[model samples]
Target: MQTQGHDLVSTLDERTSNIRATIENVLVLPLSRHPSPRSVLIIGCGIVGAATAFFLARRGVDVTIIEREGPASAATGAADGAVSVASKRPGPMMVAALSGVALYRELLGDGTLTDLFKPRSTFVVAASDAECAVLEAHAGALRGEGVAVEMLAHETLIARFPALSSNVRMGAEVKGDGHAIGYRIVNRLLSLSGVTVLRGVEAYHLVEAADGRIVAVATSRGELSADAVVIAAGNGAPTLLNCDGVMKPRKGQLLVTERAPALNASMPGSIMSGRYLLSKGSQKGAEVSARGYGLVVDPLVTGQFLIGGTREDSDARQTNDLEAVRHILTDAVAMVPGLADIRLLRAFAGVRTAVIDGLPLVGRLPGRNNLFVAAGFEGDGICLGPVMGQAIAAMACGETPSLDLSSFDPARFTSLEVAA
Candidate 1:
């Protein structure tokens, strides 16, 4: 297993050599016009923070990341890595999700993520009449956005994916969706950017100057000053920004299964349950409860299966309850009966930070020019992390972001009044 992992790493290194050289050349070159924030401090080491540091460093800005835990020790380390837009509605989030997917593809082409990203379609399946109806409308929305989608009838679905159970009434093959492991992507970005990461440091408060600009961060270790500050610390942001009411924790449980090469190979892509749309409140009339179970069975490159989980309005991250695990597996096995034979390997949970309004906070704070917030992505962090990081980095440098972030501006939460 170690030898195989080493060989895979070597192959990826070879694949990324050309692009790595180009990026390194750009990094070594001095910038003609110095950006205002010559030095920036980021308050997280998750994927979003790592990506933000990478983009900032790439633009010749000195970047330092401080985290309460090690890299990917929080939600980023626990994500399912679904780079998908199939679950989003036709709104700002959907648009951002599309851009996020494009960015992943762009990174892959440039060898920045050649091996880390796996491009494949997401199959959203329906097992009931009500589910099929919701799925049809969802497919229409995806098509309207020019997303490649194939609405499969029951017979066609059975023909295409024989591993799926007979209970699957229909399925929609949403192309351009992909899967990636969260921790791997975070590590790669950090390695490529080569920025300083201060682990085991807790960021407590933001030190502001009389001019209403964030000048430093008060940490557990000591006060660290910087030209600019970014609060992307997930659950930690609400306290630092004094907007506790704006962010809440949503827990999710995920499971992994032992290797099943033949069963894994049978599926072309990850399987998303139609009920997941309802659970995520993607359907207009769908009501989301305090606890909802959404099924997603993803086949990994190592011939293992990744299944998940329950979305609960709780902050319990260290433990997974039997009820949630049982419900998730029941749904997963119902969709793909072949999973019944596979032994369960592991079950873990993570608490994702979600905003009250659903949309993420990804732009400059209301009146703080050098202060930025990029948290509250909920479950979409894995998909939006890198792209939003690049955008936030641009915003910090007083440049145009790759994606329009007006919809996600931090000013939306009026209660978040930063102390000057």
Candidate 2:
């Protein structure tokens, strides 16, 4: 990290030595520039901000990212990394997910993320008729989008995974889905994509020019100049942007079991309960219904089954409650009988950003020309981040985005009071 100023590292340890070499695989750059920047400043280092920075850099944009912590330190760190499109609801959300699938394909094709982009099938199993209906409809929706889906009957599903409880009525398999380690991809994007980063600084205030356009941001590290800013800071976005209730935090708990003994064969991808279908997006008068039943029995690459999760409409103070863990595991054991014998290692939690309307707020902020908002992705951030990043970048460059973002306008719910 070659910085012209000593103040940049005044409070740092030796980790700032190479910036990029701090981690074996991470790449980092310091805040250094010639004249004032006409560049864009992204206020998060999660998947969305990272992808936005990557695309912006490709467009010759001088990018400076101000991350309160390190990259992938929050929501991105806690992601299951499932690139499953079937999990997306119908309409614009699914359309963006299709774009995400295409982006993953392009990224995989160019060897950008092939190694970490694990191509695996996603198995969604239903234990009851109601769930079977949901699974059947979900498969039809996926097939409607031209996604390859294979529906399985109860008997056929048993033949595939005998360890699965007989209660599982049916299942659907989507072969094209892939999973990636969230933090790994964050580091890979930083290493391969060009962006200057200032870690441990919270972007506090937005400085405006005489004509009222955003010119810079005041961070904990001091004022960093900018021409445009993207608020992809996830759960922290509301406070930073003063969007108030626009972006609320949704809490979830997950458990990682000890390495499994030799499994029957490798379980095909992840085994999602029909309950998982209920949690895809918000339901009318049913926002709270998706709280504790999205159980997934995911066998990780490390032979450890990654069991999860409980979606609580709570604040950042929520932890991995024991009862929630018990409930999640109960659902897991019901779906996969063998999981009852699996030793539990640890239980953890993460907060996802949810909007009032259940859709992400993309494009420029309501009242500001240069302030773009890409928060409120909730649990779908891992799937929609790449496409949203590209679309937001196109909007920033004054070009028409290929994705129709009219429905996702950040100002849809309320008219922001900043500028018009």
Candidate 3:
């Protein structure tokens, strides 16, 4: 009688398991049959590459992001998260920045990515009457684009940012501008579902078919075959692509200050000089007037202050440029008097992948059917990450991107013969 009872219980348990399995299959059948999913291989794990992986994974693409060392160990790791509209070019880049800001705000509201972002006002200070006029024009142009901008006098600028030096001539206040921590954002995106992050793996070459379709990627560890691949390896991209003169590594030095009470209270948001915000294309005509220095200060939530940086037009990996550090520190202290007393904590450097045309290359590679390129962000990768990822994922999935990306075409710098 005891043996018969045990057998009956086992039978009932098996029946319950079968019922549950049937229900699960019924629930997942529609989704599985919607479309055949394709696997994607992202070549870098910086902000641009990680964010691209996140966006693609969210769209149900099987994503595997391979990094040489670790996530954000390159430019994204050392970036100062200044998501400012002032830093971008006038047209499509600016539009994309604004769109990314909106997406960040939405993510914050949804509590999905709140820890990665912080909302703060951004200011552009002018040091002379000419710069003040330029600020006025910039403010007007931003306002014309429906962005919230306020022009403030020197006195008003001093009052609003009490830490600002009295020599500030004028300022433009952008209400919605803020900063996002880059590495944190990358980690958050990596933790999402449908994404596989492989650190300490270096991508070496692209394995393409005779038809010019990328079929596999050769890496230091091994080969990874994918339906599509995105090259976002920052300055390392040009080396991997074997494409000459497509990307160059521009070094930037930054410094951090020990946590200080005086500096905490006067933490002015992302600050920029009017000349620094001028179009890079206009630098040739105003080379003598342009200052190679820009100051950005943010009082991190940890109480430590972040200050940066000097754009050095070199590809070297030397981070200990004491002269550049001294210049940056002097300018930062000049902008925020309270920062003068702060103790120097540490200094670091990052190489920004810059393009000759001063815009990131996005979209499919010319003559390559399944390969894509999304690098050369320079200093704006953190700000441009989301939109670039969205565009890349859209192209991979055969969907139309929400934003127009004509300005970021890969063939823009290439001749017809080279592109073909």
lDDT of each: 0.84, 0.75, 0.73
lDDT winner: 1
- Writing each residue's lDDT as its tens digit, candidate 3 over 1-420 gives 112234433543453344334333432111121222356778998988888876776665667777888998999988888877766666677788888788788868876577668887778888878667767877876776678988888888888788788989989888797788888888877765335567788888877665666666777765667677788899878877676777777777788889886557675566777766652332223331122566677777678888877676744584767788888888888777788877999998888888877778888777876678899988888888877887788877777788788888888866312221
TM-score of 3: 0.86
Q: Which residue segments of model 3 deviate by more than 4 Å?
A: 1-37, 278-291, 415-420
**Candidate 2 runs further than 4 Å off:** 1-38, 282-286, 418-420
Per-model TM-score, in order, reads: 0.91, 0.87, 0.86
* Global lDDT of model 3: 0.73
Span of 10 residues, lowest total lDDT, candidate 2: 4-13
In Å, residue 371's CA in model 1 sits off its true spot by 0.0
Instruction: Compute the lDDT for candidate 2.
Output: 0.75
Sort the predicted structures by TM-score, highest score first: 1, 2, 3
User: By lDDT, is 1 or 2 better?
Assistant: 1
TM-score comparison, 2 vs 3, better candidate: 2
Error of 2 at 37 (Å): 8.4
